[model samples]
Target: MAALLEYLPLILFFAVYKFVDIYWATGVLIVTSSIQLGYHHFAHGKIATRHWIFFAIALVLGGLTILFQDEQFIKWKATVIYAVLAVSLIISRYIFKKNLVEKALIGVLKSANEKGDTDAPLNIELPKHICEQLNLMWVAILAFIAGLNIYIAYNFSLDFWVNFKVFGLMGITFVAILITMAKIYKYLPEDQS
Candidate 1:
């Protein structure tokens, strides 16, 4: 359900593209992304930084595509966004001495503990090596996605690119997420007997 909500804008964009045209789809995407961001902000009292970044990119790129009457801007939106994220993750991990993946996981565990959802007190500290590796993995994933989007945009038809953006990218991301979770499972604290 949460995942579906996360993809709502892209799904709507694909539907609008099929029903009408790229311009209309771009317009719908902008509106839907704004709404999604607003909903998250209102419901959670804060929005994820990544969601905010994506929303800004959607508005700017979608606006450019609509205003200039060129789909290329919108096509390059994913690549630019993903590249920015990849760079940011790398900088955070290396320059800032922060591991976003580990921080995010620890944040979730902290929230769960605050909500009394855990059977035992959760340890927020992760092994330094694990954090470094997780951050690198995320950076690699984002870079790969950025390259994949650009490759598809340049090589495929607009319709095919749209389908790949909405479905293929999501599928690949889901699998990557599963793999990441599996890789990190061994690092999780053991259940208290």
Candidate 2:
């Protein structure tokens, strides 16, 4: 159920794209994301601010694309969102001593802190300096993904873009998460008990 919710936007967007227009697809995604956000807030006592912001941007860009009747606007939507996220991550590291990724990483670190031994610490606690360095890497990867989207969209067709939006992104993100988890595993303490 929770897993489905995470993928709902992409699924809704893809379905609408297949049956309707791109703008309609985007609109449906916005609506579904709003509902999902509201549900999370009321039921889980949490709000997905990042997703909400991205959805808002998608809505505006989708509307603009439809209004101008130019597919380029819609294509550029991914680029704009990715660039904004990357820049924000980089800035947060420098100005706030922590970025979005570090905050999220902390959640995992805290759990590891409570459970794992200190035989070989990954220092998942992550100092400010390390967070800054990580933010740089994160921003670069994000930009790379955005650039890949642009390259594919320009050279290929809409179908390819939509498929990449789901399968390609999901696959790549899964791999990245796995890599992170593996690294944590390596640094895990020897005490299994």
Candidate 3:
């Protein structure tokens, strides 16, 4: 349910774009994203940081697209979001000394353990350097995605870009998440417990 809600905006945007046009799609994106944000706030009592970032940018870029009667503004939204995420990851890892990937892995491990799951690995900590390497991998992945978006949006047709944005990028993102999880298994010591 939550996952569906999270993707509702993108799914609807793609459908609307297919039926009508970019301008209408941009409007739909903004409206649906705003609704998603509101749903998060209403249900959770607060919106997540990523939700805020996405909504704010989508609203601004979508607005620009409508106002200027140009699809280029909306085309850049995904790239901008990815760039912001990459920069934020770099800043958090360096300035704040926080590795979000490590934290996410730890949290998942913790939850699995707490659930009394036999498959859950022991709370063995990953080495700091290995964690840093993992974080850098994510940063690189995001930067690559951002660059890819720009390249495709400019070179390809808007319809192609829309399909890539909605389905292709989503597939890539899911694979990235799975890859991150796979890293924990690869780098961490086998839980002999």
Q: Best candidate per TM-score, number?
A: 1
Query: For each candidate, what is the lDDT?
Result: 0.86, 0.75, 0.87
- Model 1, 100-187: lDDT tens digits are 7888877776665767745677764567887777788888988999999999999999999999998888888888778777766776
Per-residue accuracy of model 2 over 1-193 as CA lDDT, tens digit each: 8779878987998999999978788778778877888878988788767867877887787778777877777787777887888888877776776687768777777666666655454444445655555667678878888898899889999999989987887787677677555544544444521
| Alpha-carbon shift of residue 57 in model 1 (angstroms) | 0.7
In model 2, where do residues sit more than 4 Å from their true spots? Answer: 109-133, 189-193
Residue by residue across 48-103, what tens digits does model 3's lDDT show? 99998899999999999999999999999999999998898899988998998788
- In candidate 3 the C-alpha lDDT for residue 22 amounts to 92
Task: Pick the lDDT winner.
Answer: 3
Ranked by TM-score from best down, the candidates are: 1, 3, 2
lDDT of 1: 0.86
Q: In model 3, how large is the Cα lDDT of residue 78?
A: 91
